[model samples]
Target: MISFRPVDVDSDAEMEMLHRWVTHPKAAFWLMQDFDVEQVREEYRRISEHPHHEAFLGLVDGNPAFLAERYDPGHVELVGLYEPEDGDVGMHFLCAPTDTPVHGFTRTVITAVLAWIFADPDALRVVVEPDVRNTAVHALNAAVGFRVVGPIAKPEKQALLSVCTWHDFQSATSALPRLGASL
Candidate 1:
């Protein structure tokens, strides 16, 4: 089972683990490959301090497997980028790199994360602004119900803004296998 907990940036071991994952070549989209451990600590510390933002560590059957971030679009990431609506929340997730790849693992993780987010009564819709160049994530997001809202320019990179509502997610996952059903 996949579960989540608040990231404890104060823990050296956790920070080290996060550092290794973020610095890995596959994490280019994460934009922190050149950062040292302290830089990661500083960045996550900043996130931890933000009122509308929070980071979570994802665990699969008790071992760390991914990281997810949740933020209020109205108050943080999408502030001036676009108009924000009530109950709109922003999401970002990263799976740990592995030597053994599993088909549908990314799908399951994202489905789980979105489900987790929707569990919050206030979260009616999920938002994301991933880099346009990250085509893999675009496909993954589509499988989970996100609809492209067109491209938007950000200081860092051009991004594809997408949104997935509760209904959209439900419709998308209705025919899909869930976490415990052999996937």
Candidate 2:
């Protein structure tokens, strides 16, 4: 089963693993490509201390599979990054590096992440701003019910802003098959 739990980024081993994941070539769009070990540690330290954001390490059958964060866009991610609307909560996820692409793994990870975010009573919508060229992630986001709003140009890259409201998400995905369950 895929699950998410609060992570203790203060742990040395966890920090090391996170550093490797963020710096991996496949994670290039994550924007930490040139990060050093110390920088990674410091970044986690900041996240751990931030009040508006919560970080979780996603696990599948006790194996680390991804990193996820849930935060208020008005406070952290979309502070000066985008024009945020009320009830907007930003989401970020990074899948761990793997040589073999596991079928349905990304879908499961995204579903698990969205489930966790919407679990909060105050969360009305989930917003994501991924690189416009990241077609893989755009497809995954759509699978979870997010629809594109428009594109925004950032200093680092052009991003496609997308949102999935609680009601829309519920309606769109209600009949969709989950990765592990038999259709």
Give the per-residue lDDT digits (tens) of candidate 2, residues 1-183: 677777776788888899999999999999999998789888877887899888888888778889998888888766686778877888999989999989877777787778777877778889998999999999988877999998987777899989999887777678766533110
In order, candidate lDDTs are: 0.91, 0.83
Task: Give one digit per residue, the lDDT tens place, for model 1 in 2-117.
Answer: 88989999999999999999999989999999999999999999999999999999999989999999999888887799888899999999999998989988899899999999
- Cα TM-score per model: 0.96, 0.89
Model 1 root mean square deviation, Cα atoms: 2.5
lDDT, residue 151, model 2? 90
Best by lDDT: 1
